[model samples]
Target: MSALAPDPRFVSQAPGPGQRSPFLRRLAHASEPWLYSAPALILIVAVMLVPLVLGISYAFRDVRLLNPFSGGYVGLQHFHELARDKAFWGALKNTLWWTGASVFLQFFLGLFLALLLDKPFYGRGIAQALCFLPWAVPSFLSGLNWAWLFNPVVGPLPHWMVSLGLMSQPENILSDPTLAMWGPIIANVWWGIPFFAITLLAALQSIPRDLYEAAAIDGAGGVQRFFSITLPFLAPTIAITVLLRTVWISNFADLIVVMTSGGPANRTQIVASYIFTQAFKKLDFGYASAVALVLLVLLLAYSMLIVLLRQSLLKKG
Candidate 1:
């Protein structure tokens, strides 16, 4: 038999001066994009990669500003301490509550607002603005207002609620252990609604009016039109929004810090604030970093799960 043809590298397979291999040709034909996308790549590396490295560094070394040598290479001691921490578990649970409730409530309420506001009506613009008002307000500043509103007295809101019998005797919403956590959830939900509404409203507007009109002609009612045309089209946006907000709320420690300090007795502690308490309040940097690392792991796991679930559902659909 004739000897096997020489490999392409051994015998140059030059088609022409301008011609190239299929793979190389495709790559050459398409812009390499290194220079064009370099700025974004650098920015992502600088912002995300640097901070992540720092976070991991802090996790390993028991360093504090007071003493750089406060650092000790006590391998997995931090993780062990965090594993034994009651506060960490409590905080993790609260994080779940905040993220789960906030995302759910925000999506539905915002979708409702987007739908109603998308429709023709007098003063619709004003109504939309009002609905979005909470989002316009700064989060910490809004927390203060919510904090005051839930105060037992001195605030009009609780007093008015008592008079309206919506709550009994100027109820201190956050005074109770059970109610404190929900206050932040409620505040976050109110603040978050506009974001979802605005995102979804833009998507909703892009939808053709003809679809609705055609559905109506087919005798589908408002509810039917919504479920069929609106929801299927809007589902992807809703999923994206929920996933983003879930991740966002999962790390939220500010509102809890400002409003309750994780308290009425550590009742409202979340992993973020718990980490804060461990690091600064308790002076356990190594242990705190362990908790932080665990928190990061949980979020990473959840995010991966969500992506996989989304892909699976997309495939099935």
Candidate 2:
């Protein structure tokens, strides 16, 4: 029996001394990057992902803040109520208007400013800084400032409108249901335009100077060169910025909350402000979460649609 000599294959398969097994070595190699990133990953999971999951779960549960025993599961009852909520429907419509008008004004005005800033001029640096001043201001402060401007008592905007025949007389537009949404919309546009201006200016500067020069030499007009070269060069940037800004503006409640508090009979209540009202004012955390989830889904669908359209346009180009 002489130690029925160990098979050479088995001997070769086993790790010797303190050496790691092949499986362990492979796992260590694979996990090295994750080990380095563990802190950030853990922080994100704790701060963002955990809350997100909890919020989604709350959407299906009766998690009213006023009630101690309100954590019971309610399934889709909140959503069912949302379906019949006229206020929710109205807010959704207002959300569409708010997002569309704000994004449209911001992008075009910002593009114009970007184009103007891209050109060389004396005191251009000062001009650029002044143009971007609005964005540097906090949203809350901007909202307050704009609110005051819309006030007829101390602010001059209403008086100016009166002088220009845009208004019948000095009055607080924020108190008017027919015009209250415009108050926040104007404030948002002013605050958000600088974001587009900065991003679009960077993209504009990256375009080849020789392309514009060549177009000019070929007797192309400013409009022709812009449409043919500038716009084409800016298409991708425009698409992405528009999509992101649309989503952002849709979720933005700061201006409305500060300026109008979604007031004038909730006429200016956007979905985002409505969510705030439900969550903090009414303490209906479950219903608020449901509305938030619906908003998330809607934004996600919109983003996907925009991405698909961009891809198709790129393919065609």
User: What is the TM-score of each predicted model, taking all chains together?
Assistant: 0.81, 0.88
Q: How many clashes in candidate 1? A: 0
In terms of lDDT, model 1 sits at: 0.81
lDDT of 2 by residue, 59-148 (tens): 999998989989999999999999999999999999999999999999999999999999999999999999999999999999999999
Error of 2 at 315 (Å): 13
What is the Cα-based lDDT of residue 48 in candidate 2?
97
Candidate 2 residues lying further than 4 Å off, grouped into runs, are 1-28, 305-317
User: lDDT of each prediction vs. the true structure?
Assistant: 0.81, 0.92
Task: Tell me how far the alpha carbon of residue 119 in candidate 1 is from the true structure, in angstroms, after superposition.
Answer: 0.5
